[model samples]
Target: MTETKKTTEKTLRRFTLSWQLALGMASGFFVIFIIFAFVLSQILKQYYGRLPETLYQWLGITILLGGLFVFGFAFMLTRYILRPVKSIKTTIEAFEDDPMTNVRADRANVNDEFYDLVNILNRMIDRLQSLIGAQQQFVSDVSHELRTPVTIVKGHMDLLNRWGKDEPEVLEDSIKSSLAEMQRMETLINEMLNLTRAEQIPIENVQEVTEVGGLVHRVFDNFKLIHPDFIFTLDDDLTQDANVKVRQDHMEQILIILADNAVKYSLDRKEIHFALSQTTNRVEIGIQDFGEGLSSEDAARVFDRFYRVDKARSRAKGGNGLGLSIAQRLVKAYGGEITLESALGSGSVFTIRLPLQRENKNDQKLSN
Candidate 1:
């Protein structure tokens, strides 16, 4: 009942402005007509002795015509002012019904206030689109990432109960496998939390000059230490002069995530390649590995949080599957992009592109 009342009040308020303007115009015209009628009567009494019988009739006819004209003019003026507002209301209704609907208002030749409103609405729609896409991707990726660990945990428990009783060593191994699966689950949960935290924190405070090549080298060296069996090589294309404006820690984390994933998924003792190059406006970094490459469908979802191509293999290799997602987010935060190219059995490559800074060039020139 309260909601209904509130809605009715709102609708009444919307019409109030037009009605007020009409009433004001009507009052002003009435006052003017009275003054004119009084003046004419006085002039006739003075110059023509007394007013003729048709004088009153002619005066009434004139007033009636004037009132009609004023009414029409006021109505037209009110409608002209309210047209854009009505359009905005219709667009909002459509959006409420289906958010995917694109209802853009024409801004050309429009009043400045209306044009500003249209621009704001367009920006709001763009943000809504991004948010909805992210939400859908999160749901799909989380489902895929959870399934493998649950299956493995169940399988290991079953094995432990069946053969574990007969062989002590088998029981221990089964228990260990279950523990490993749990650990994988824990890691996945941690990665998800980290990703969420990263999304929530504003990046406004994070500004610094970052050396692109040096950051990549540090990440590579760290990965080499962690996965000693994997052969890693860095291309010399990236010079010491390559630098960009970004948060240093965030850039390092992005590189580490990509390089770490490459090392983890690559075949044992296989070579992983890291390459970097600078252009006039941007810098590109690539990480490639000879691993069990993904299918087209997998490639499409690799950057989604918690999505993995090979479920069993991903669990066996202890991947939470959020590395690429985190890496992509970090890259985008720095006004950069991350893309993947992969084929089954051949290999996979991940590339990152970041915008170059003027300060970087100035620094390089000074050093030279």
Candidate 2:
């Protein structure tokens, strides 16, 4: 009750800008009227013994007209100043009442502060609409993707409850199929979580400096060990050790993802290339795979969540199709970029570019 009372008091005490401006103008006019009346009375006393009754009447009439004019002017000026604010308020209220309705604050004819404010508001509304559309689409896609496995599992459970429990073959197959579907769902959920996490990297992680060359070598060696049959080659042209403003673990993860993708898509030729090079201002890591490459259209959307060149093959290979999306998000978070070059039946090369972390000479001198 006390807090509510305090909040109510604060709200009641708050003064609107229009009221403040009106009061200020009215006060200034009142002060000027007092000064003018005093000066006129002094002039009358100096010029004559006493002021005339007619002069007093004329002064009273003039004061009345002046006061009325001052007040009227103040009211109009306040209204003119607050017109834009009222328009913005009405637009926001309408938007709040019907969020789906695309309402925007009207822009002013003059390029002033209010015009800039209107532009910002329109941009914010557009962004909100876009986010709402994307959110709806995302929810729909997730539901569609999960429905298949859920339905399959439920169907198997119903079969087992009816008669499959007694038959050994039916029970075995149903159990395996159900478990597989459950595993796929688990994988899908994890990837979705990873994708979300990739979008919002921690502030501390942004400040982290990672040596790119070592991470590249580590991932290359790991992949070689995992795929002994596949030929792996590393081309390291970086004469000096280069660092980037990215977490070591994130860099390693990106490399592993690209390498894994290369291994997965390699149809006949089991050859993968890991190239590490550096320019003056950036470090580049390229993972080239002689795999069943993608078409131009597929390559364009390969980084989209749940997109796959071959859905059946992707499912068969236990791919949830979120790896590239996560990689792309992580790369972009640190002001890096990931590019894909592929031609059907030729090969694919995934290249990542990261800004090199510059060494602070002052810090180095301080350490010395």
Candidate 3:
């Protein structure tokens, strides 16, 4: 019974103001006309004796015309009220047939509740379309990336099975090639898992005030030790009061990804620079490298998973092309943005902007 009452209420709620107005107007007119007709007929009979046939005929015609007018007026009002709902239904059906259509709903000034519902549904559709497109592209990129290595390994194994097994030279070359491809595959899979985890990482997981300068210093030291042949510079222009809203570990991981990319692309110039600066609202961290800088076209897609500027060179450098993409997701998960600026042969700069946290005395104490 409770369920039935709730359902009834829901049904009634769908009716717009116009419907209620039309119903009330019709009911009020019906009562008024009934009383007026009875009163007029009695008065006419009492004063003028019997009524004429023409009078009755004219009265019948007037009643018919009034009823028709009322019916037309009520119908027009009801239809106007339902116009938004009809549009919503049509749009939904059209989308069900082909969702590639425009994801927005076209409706006039609908009732308040229904207007809100339409807006929510359109937003949901936008998100759904985005998720679907991303998933499809992700699958395509993964398959393409996996295919090359798998084909290489399989080809080498086939060669070994056919004749390379007995020939020592072919056996040694085939074994090395297969092992290298397998390692590449492993690295790609691991990075893909990292991106997946980054996508689902909760805000609470990274809810900590991390000092930007110290994090960069640590990363600089680590990279300096790891690549002793290359020059690493740190330019810290931020105040000691600079605190960013991010987890320390996530921030470090982001720095590592950017630094690694810089090191990989350092063509002839073996220098990499890390810079930290801040505005009133945001903290900016930059990793600049004098490298085989990418063209605008390449720069645009550099953050896409499995996208590499030079596949052959990337393979040679043991890069699976997922580093930047993973870094982007990780940074964005913490309300940060990662961007790239580069030109052909003019070096590249990767900048990460994190929203600055409100100045906290506790953060300074923690850093100490």
- What lDDT does candidate 2 reach at residue 49? 74
- How displaced is residue 281 in candidate 1, in Å? 1.0
Q: Model 2's lDDT to the true fold?
A: 0.85
lDDT of 1 at 306: 62
- Cα lDDT tens digits for candidate 2, 296-341: 9999999998898899999999898889998998999888899999
TM-score of 2: 0.78
**What are the per-residue Cα lDDT tens digits for candidate 3 across 1-368?**
99699667656665555567777776677667667777888899999999999988887787767766776687677777677776786678667867766846664678886888888878777766666665666677679788988999989989999989689999999999899888888888888778776775667656678888888888899999989999998888987566877778778889999999899888888999999899989999999999889888999999987788888898898888888988999989888898899988879999999888885799779989
- What is the lDDT of every predicted structure here? 0.78, 0.85, 0.82
Per-candidate TM-scores read 0.69, 0.78, 0.70
Best lDDT among the predictions, by candidate number: 2
Q: Could you tell me how far off, in angstroms, the CA of residue 344 lies in candidate 3 after the best superposition?
A: 7.0
Q: What is the lDDT of residue 326 in candidate 2?
A: 89
Look at candidate 1 and tell me the lDDT of residue 290. Answer: 91
- Give the candidate number with the greatest TM-score: 2
Which runs of model 3 end up more than 4 angstroms from their true locations? 1-66, 164-176, 189-211, 228-231, 240-250, 267-270, 291-307, 325-347, 357-368
Model 3 pairs in collision = none
Cα lDDT tens digits, model 1, 1-368, are 99699778867876786778776777687778778887988988899897887988888888888777776777677767776776677667667877778776556656777888977877777667666656665567568677977998888888877887999998888888888878877887777766754554345666677888877888888878887778889885865467677778778878888777887777754889999898888889999999888899989988876677776776677776778888887777777889999998878999999988666587779999
